[model samples]
Target: MKEYKRFLLYGLVVGTVIGFYLIFNLKSFVSYENIFIDKTDFMLSSRLIIYNKTCGLQHWKEKKNFGHRDDIPFFSILSTILSSTEKKIIIIEFGANVGQFSERVLSIPHKIPYIVHSIEPVLTLFHLLRNRSRTFKKEKNDKHFHYNLAISDQSGEKPIYSPSQYGEGSTLGKAFLSNFKEIENVTVTTLPEFIKKYHIKTPISFIKIDVEGFEPEVIRGMNLSINAKIFPLFSFETGETWLDDRSVLAKEYTLKSFVEMLNYFQYDSYFIGNPYLLPISGTYWKNSFDGLRRNPNVLAILRHSQPWKNLKKLLNRIPFTSC
Candidate 1:
C-alpha cells in the first residue's frame, strides 16, 4: 500500500509540473508582448548591432538576413502611388516571421501615414516578432504592429508543420520537406475577420506573402478585401511543388486557377526587378510557373490603378531584368 501511495504521489507531482508548463506556454502564446526583448536583451552583437536572433543551433553565426531590404523598392513604388491620395495606407504581411519585413517597412521614412499588420502563426516565431517589434518601439518608432495567429480560409485550428530548418519550411499543409520533426496545431483567423475584429478602417496598399505553400488559402480568406476592390499590390512566393500535392487546396487553388482568379479581379502581373509591367492579357501567364520557381517573388499590380500609372514612370528609370 505504501509503495502504491508513493507511486501515486510521484505521478501527481509529474502531472502538476507538466500542467504548469503548459499553462505558462499558453499564456506566452496568447500574449506575445509578455516576453518582449529589447536592446538590453542580447549579451553580444553590441557594436555591430544585429537584428532578431534566429532559432538555429549556432545563433551567433546564423545569418540575420530576412529579405527585408528587398522589399524597399516596392515600398518606394507605393509611396509614389499614394503621393497625392490622402487614403491611409495599411500593409498586411501574412508570414511576417521574425518581423524583418515589418521592421524594414516601419523603420524607413514614410511619405504617407501607414500601419502594418505583421502576422506570424508559429508561437515560437511570433514571440520573436513581438520582441523585434518591441525593439522598434524602443527607438521611438511605432508603425510596426504584430499579431499572433495564422490567417487562413477559416477561423479555427490547423496543424502546422515545422521543419528542422527553423523558420525556413514551416507550413499549414503537409507539403513541406520530409525532414520536418515537429508538428504544431495553431489558431487561424481570416483577413476580413481580423480587420473587423481590430477595427482596421484603412485600405490595404501592399502585402507580402511568404507562407511556404499556403499563399492560396490566404488569398481565399481575403475575399472581402478583393470584392471591395481594395486589392493591394502583392509580393508572393510561388513554386511548382506548392501545388503538386493532391491536397484539397492544391486541387482547387492550383496555379492556373489562382491566376484566373486574379484576372477576374483585373490584376496584371510582373516579375520583380523588371522595368516593364506585364499587361493583364500578356503572354507572361505561360511562363508564370517557370518564373515562380526560378525567381519566386512576383509582383501583382492592379491594372486600372491610377497610382500604377505614376509608379510606372519610376520603373522606367530603373533597369529591367527577367526574373
Candidate 2:
C-alpha cells in the first residue's frame, strides 16, 4: 500500500509540472519550426547585404531589386490603365502573406496606389507583415496599414490550421496539407463590416484575395461592395486544390459561386495564365480549371471600369500575352 501511494504521489507531481510547463511555454512549443531559420535576418534585405543567408534551406527570399524593379504583368497593366493623378484610392489585400503583394503593388513605379491595407492571420507572418509595413510606411508615410485578422463571412474568432512546411497555407477552413495542426485562433470580420468599423469613407479601388479554401466565405461577405457603382478590380485565387476538396467548402459556394457572383456584377473574369489573362466565358471555367495542381490566379474586371477601357492601348505597349 505504501509503495502504491508513493507511485501515485510521484505521478501527480510530474503531471502538474508538465501542465504548467506547457501552459507557460505554449507559444514556443507551437512555433517550434522557427528553430531552423534565424528570425531576425528574415526581414527585408539591405542593398549592401553580403550573403544570401538562404543556404538552400528556406523556400522564400528577400527581393532587394526594388530600385530596378520589374513589377508583375497584371499590376503593370493596371498601372498603365489607371490615370496617374487618381488619388484617394485604396487597395485591400486579403490573405496577405508577409505583405509580399502589398510591397509589389506599392513598388509598381508608374501609377501609384493611394494606400495599401494588408490583412494577415498567421501569428508569425502577421508580425513579419506588420514589421515590413513599417519600412514601406517610411517610404510612403501613412500609405500602408496592417491588420492581424482573418476575413470571412462573419465577425468572430476562428481557429486556423497550418503546416510547418507551408506556413503561408494558414486558413480558417479545413487544412488539407499533409502535416497540419491547429496553429491558432484568429479574430474574424467581414470586409464591409471592417470598413464600417474603421469608418473608411473612401471607395476601395482594388482587392486581392488568396485565402486557401475560404474564398467562398470571403466572397459571400462582399454583398454590398460588389454592387457599388465603382466596382473594385479583383485578382483572387479561385481554382486552388483545397477549395474543391468537397470536405473544404460546399460546391455551390466554391468556384461556381465565384463565377456566378462575377457574372451578376457584370464583371468579366479571366484566367491569369502564365503571362496571358485568358477570358472565361460560356462553359469555359467548367472545363478549364485544374485545381489539383497550382492553378493560375483569376482577374475580375468590370467592363465599364477605367482600366478595362484603356486595356487595348496598354496591350500595344506592354504585351500581356505570351504567344
Best by the TM-score measure: 2
Worst 10 residues of 1 by lDDT: 48-57
Q: Which portions of model 2 show Cα errors greater than 4 Å?
A: 1-73, 83-86, 111-113, 137-142, 175-178, 224-230, 243-250, 253-257, 283-286, 290-292, 320-322
lDDT of 2 by residue, 15-109 (tens): 99998986774432233322122246534421111111121112111212111112244575565555322465577888888877787677666
Rate residue 54 of model 2 by lDDT.
Answer: 26
Each candidate's lDDT (Cα)? 0.59, 0.59
Superposition TM-score, candidate 1 onto the true structure? 0.66
Error (Å) of candidate 1 at residue 102 is 1.2
Best by lDDT: 2
Clash count, predicted structure 1: 0
lDDT of 1 by residue, 1-323 (tens): 99999999999999999999868844532342212222473334111111111121122123221122344445544455542224456788988889777776676665456677898888788888888787763233336678878887889988777665455557777643565555677889887888889887645677787777777777777883444355546767666546546135745664556666776776665434212233222443453344234424556666646545555444323332212
